[model samples]
Target: MRRAAPLALLAALGAAPLAAQDSAPCGGDFGTFLQGVEAEAVASGIDPATASAFVAGLGPDPEVIAADRRQGVFQLDFLTFSRRLISQDRIDRGRAMADRHATTFDRIEAEYGVPRGVLLAFWAFETDYGAVQGDFGTLDALATLAHDCRRPELFRPQLVAAAELFAMGEIDHATTGAWAGEIGQVQMLPADILENGRDGDGDGRIDLKGSAPDALMSGGAMLQALGWRADEPWLVEVTVPDGLDWASTGLNHPRPVANWAAAGVAARDGALPGGGPGTGLEARLLLPQGRNGPAFLAYPNFDVYFEWNQSFVYVTTAAYFATRLMGAPIYLAGDPDPGLSGEQMIALQEKLVARGHDVGGVDGILGERTREAVQVEQQRLGLPADAWPTPALLGAL
Candidate 1:
């Protein structure tokens, strides 16, 4: 299940009309919010001149809020999401990038243990290989999100980090980024950039926006922090035999390759997905669509994908597409059981939340949390623990 946290953060700031209404500090004025932020910045040891100059006249971005409410990616199924994001054109562009930056990629891979194909796939997904990174200023976007009532708690730290970067003269005040304050083609937040950003181009500075090498290298550093294993495959498509313990599926339950092999698990194709099979790798089964869809066993490095994005579809597709870029065949199979309609999913979420299972949200999106909740519900009802939501569940509820 993909967590839409980053997207959830920045979905609402846009070039919307600035509000005409004005109010006192801490009431409702955007100016007041900016002033408060500046005061806080000065107290935090940021240069008073920089703080005052930075927040002056920053307006409330109403359009960003509008965009936030209209997010439909979370509502999309894996098949639809994959089809929309992992297009042939994107693959082609990725391949071209890989070829063009072969030297840089080879060097980064040799140094960081991250493959070129993986970086290319992520680059293609993040900003279409540096083609369309958003135009929102980082400070403005973070500030706007921090002030928004929906998720102020989440964006507040990011806003502070952006300010710090500005204060240090690391990120220019005019630096543009995605709505969520993600800078460069990789769409990383200010903190992540400050912490993991690298001088990939070796030009004495880190410029992720202009330097693909920097983004890719910095991204590899971030993955290393998340426990990505160079020796292990992130995930591998696999087949699960009938009569298996359905509850054992998902990322939380990993087992040795021998354990899964003993239980009749095997690769979808003839060979191990990435590395050789004799490596004694451990894996957790990931049935994105319950027991009736494309299943894979996630390895250690798989955790790094979640670090990149909470969305299973987005992360998995990036990993999956990376393999495709390296000449591996795509998963051409269909789900044995389809996903639920939006209304059905919404109903299911409401029922699960009412029961205190923590489905995460009642927003109709079936993610890992919701699926796990469904599994618990199924177990309680003495049904199969495939972790799928169905019409049968609705009636049971």
Candidate 2:
């Protein structure tokens, strides 16, 4: 899921105006919200005890909302984020954890057909391998988000699912430990916990808090359900030939490897991996830092990484971390330009919009659509079509 924006954090804290009210009308009291929620739970067939226990102390939590807002600023750059999250210390810790819980990870990989490294990588990323599950009350966070107006439509159902968890005795109101009501070491949402979590430890309880086996196994199970191919790579860094037609490479428009080779696109070492000719997998050419930076051929499984975290940088970092875990070399190329500011990006978007070009939503985030729009404008202006955002581009705009 995308990290909660600043506005989302404010709304979750009940600092923003209610969606139902136009001009800061009287807000719904906690008592009133709980009463309505209790009624809904009972009508939804939940027992009274479960409903009361779940809703008794639920309210807006300022600290959690603050944390959510702060998360947006924590990882400003991909390299910094990767260095912190996938540090040598982290890798050593993960390897030790994997060794200690070899039986659990082995069984999980065998059953789910997910690589142990990938599962371990996710475990390390989600909660620092259980070393730092958030200390805030999970119920409070869920209740705050559910009662808040900005994304009540998205979080209210999660609130309902949390109540169901309580009703089923899967978890009590006291044991949950996620930022947004996600439970367990893997930080799984309530619905995912209900659907995919497993008792790998076989202790007659699905304990995610204290059981490494359960958490790792549950994570592998979720990935399996998402169609993780056991032997296929998620993505690979490749060399794109000069003068290659980037428009031909899109997510929906796939061509065979042979066809791509015919078009002068070849693997970096002049040898394609053993996926056979014309595997029919669609791919896209990704130039994260324009024409001078390292390139990648992303496949469908790359999209699956986005399901975990929507940010392109997040997915790319995960893929890179996976490569590191597999003993692959780090990316040797540097980003062409990393100093672009949010204001400059916004200015560029405004200029594009003024020119009657759609750059998608102008949130100052340079996504693929924004990059493509910038490239089109650059081509129209007789500039280089590298699709990179720079201060010079902003000046031209």
Candidate 3:
């Protein structure tokens, strides 16, 4: 499915096609920032009074800025991320939670066709099954992000959406959530809530924070709206045969399940997750850790996780944990390569760019562009184009 960057809607801020926002240019003058936000709100037809009150009352959350600065996804390895995220305790708890909420999940699947495992995994990971949604006020966190120019283009629309929500009584200034103004059990961004948030509990109000039914139903609704398929498994862990075509793995290399079986890809349990006898479902190979780590057959539904969060570690972990909720084992590879530091990743990205590939601006992050570029470089060198970065590739590059 076509997707925007997670959390924030960047296009609605200024019709001027603003450049990528990565600088914190929101100088200490809070009043000036409010004036600009006020002007944008007025132009966007948001209630001026609601916008002014929110902007006027918003306080600078230095802790939010500090937390943003410390988030370093580029430096994480798959094993580390998975180990930290999917503990045995968490899996057991998730299984229990799934059983407890089976009725609701079944209802959602009967209606929306999106699986309960997917929703359950996100619930566990995003907010620990609603036990820890967040502690910051939504308005305060949103104001901090929108007022700060580092991501104003992204958060500005969120601010406008918040104003509209407030005017309509969807949220209040005291509504608390993540530092980025994400609320609800799933930590949904403001814009998505405005678009797909629903009243699942029949309460006449959408209370994502306090109501599990509302959160799951709305989450299911959003997934279906984005084209979630009932019959497809988002991803499945599998054992790729010895010396399999390593270069032939990636989201770009989709093939039929029959073709994958012919080419030596087998599900961990000898039966594919979404494939029955002669199911002929399509999937692609995902080698997140080059040829040495565990492999997966990712389907179209896998891309939707990126809709929730673009971080590979995050989306993959969510998928993995969901599978575990179905009794899948840990990885077959059993280990991940000790990964890169942020500076090292930046150097790798720079090298990839110098070799005439667009790795999305040398941002130290190994997003899709960087992974694809690495695939090209690997093919050029006649190595397995696993599309995963390695210390060896960094040195060679």
Alpha-carbon shift of residue 143 in model 1 (angstroms): 0.4
The clash count of every prediction, one per candidate, is 10, 0, 0
**Could you tell me every candidate's TM-score relative to the true structure?**
0.88, 0.84, 0.87
lDDT, model 3, position 142: 79
Better by lDDT, candidate 3 or 1: 3
- Compared with the true structure, the alpha-carbon lDDT of candidate 1 equals 0.72
- Residue-level lDDT of model 3, residues 286-342, one tens digit each, is 877876788899988998887777767667777887888877777776455555666
TM-score of 2: 0.84
Query: How well does candidate 3 match the true structure in TM-score terms?
Result: 0.87
Which candidate should be chosen as best, given lDDT against the real structure? 3
lDDT of each: 0.72, 0.66, 0.74
Stretches of candidate 1 exceeding 4 Å from the true structure: 1-29, 270-280
Residue 71 of model 2 has an lDDT of 39
